[model samples]
Target: MLSTSGTIIGIDSSTGACSIAVCRGGTMLAHFHEDMTRGQSERLAPMAEAGLAAAGLGFPDLDAIAVTRGPGSFTGLRIGMAFAKGLGQALGIPVFGVTGFDAVARAVFATEAAAGHGIAVILESRRADLFLQIYTTGGAPDGPPVALPPEDIAARLCQEGAAPLLLAGDAADKVLAVLDQASAAMLRSSLITAPDAREVALIGLEMAGDGDIPPALQPLYLRAPDVTAPRAG
Candidate 1:
């Protein structure tokens, strides 16, 4: 739970998806999310306002703001960070950045038991690559995230020597085909997709309470943005 009595807001415009949530003392009071491919800049502010309204609060009542740092769409991360910064500054509150994977992991770990193979979160990164991370069932890291080709990820999973693996996040479907063939006998994977805004709020609350907020709250771009300048002539 947050150490203070004020409200906290969490934003995640880190993929094609967008979400905003408000919480009081680690309990989510309201949230909004959309799986749209565009229009985040226009949608985010209203969503934030709606969340605050649902919580019977306003921007001035907030104590902190949280946002997904990334390993996601470049444009989406920028938009979310900019919004969080603006709102935090205007409200005189702190802004914290949480990774998309960490948010999802927190969400999953809250409801599930910690006795399975592990949790694998895969979010689409626009190209053929994916943003992938492995976490123990207890929300501890098995390894850091890596951007890997679908086949390579499947191959590695086949070699992991684990069973009953749980898979979640936006890109689970795309990875399923590859994983099915690669690890058919050795591993089992489930596709469960949903972003729990409440879970995000809870995690943000804990971070705020702990005073572990980042200095800048930038996006966690795991790989370089897809677009790069052309070579000098």
Candidate 2:
């Protein structure tokens, strides 16, 4: 029984950046974002508290919590999920999970930026491969998200034919670098390089308005974490 009219705080620590936004009735009341490759665990809670303070609210004032579910840094995703769920449980409210792709795509479509162009979301994976997804001009996903190297992503875009395309996400530059001049000619860069918690909040509000129960929160891992095993001492 979620309601958009109630206060909501959206959290996103799924990328190099971590952000939180407080919104009421679909309008943002406060937002705080910081760019960092690590330390999300330390910064997220304080940022969330700051957002609530700026909005003149407290934990008890929040009606629900919204958080990005990932396709991002493994540790960052876990930190965000745990924070949102813990807060929700303590407050006796629901926690909604939104994918990083959906958060960015919804923001893009809202601005009408992809009106006549295809969209390729190029999220950084911090590895040789990246999390990628394509979308039609109409804002529908062209296909499922996949983990691919920059070269393969460029090849896939080329194979889609020369419809003007918009390249988004934090890794757009990485993908753009590998595209040849001809392919590059048809592509445009979106201003949204990272998923913002403000957008996460709006999307969450929409989810609440839809009147369906929110799915469980889980990290959207596109690839296994890159870890090295220690040799026996």
Give Cα-based local distance difference scores for all models. Answer: 0.75, 0.87
Off by over 4 Å in 1: 1-5, 113-115, 180-182, 194-196, 228-233
Model 1 vs. true fold: TM? 0.87
Using all chains and alpha carbons, the TM-scores for the candidates as numbered come to 0.87, 0.93
Clashes per model (N, Cα, C within 3 A) = 1, 0
lDDT of 1 at 94: 83
User: Quick one: best lDDT, which candidate?
Assistant: 2
Question: Candidate 1 on 1-233: residue-level lDDT in tens?
Answer: 34755588888887777898888884678988898878999999999888899889988888888888777878888998899899888877788878888887776665544355577888888788888888875677778889888787776666645545677777766677765654655544444454445555666777778755547876677788666788998
lDDT of 2 by residue, 37-136 (tens): 9999999999999899999999899888889998998889999999999998999888889889988887777777778887888898878998998888
What stretches of model 2 exceed 4 Å from their correct place? Answer: 160-162, 230-233
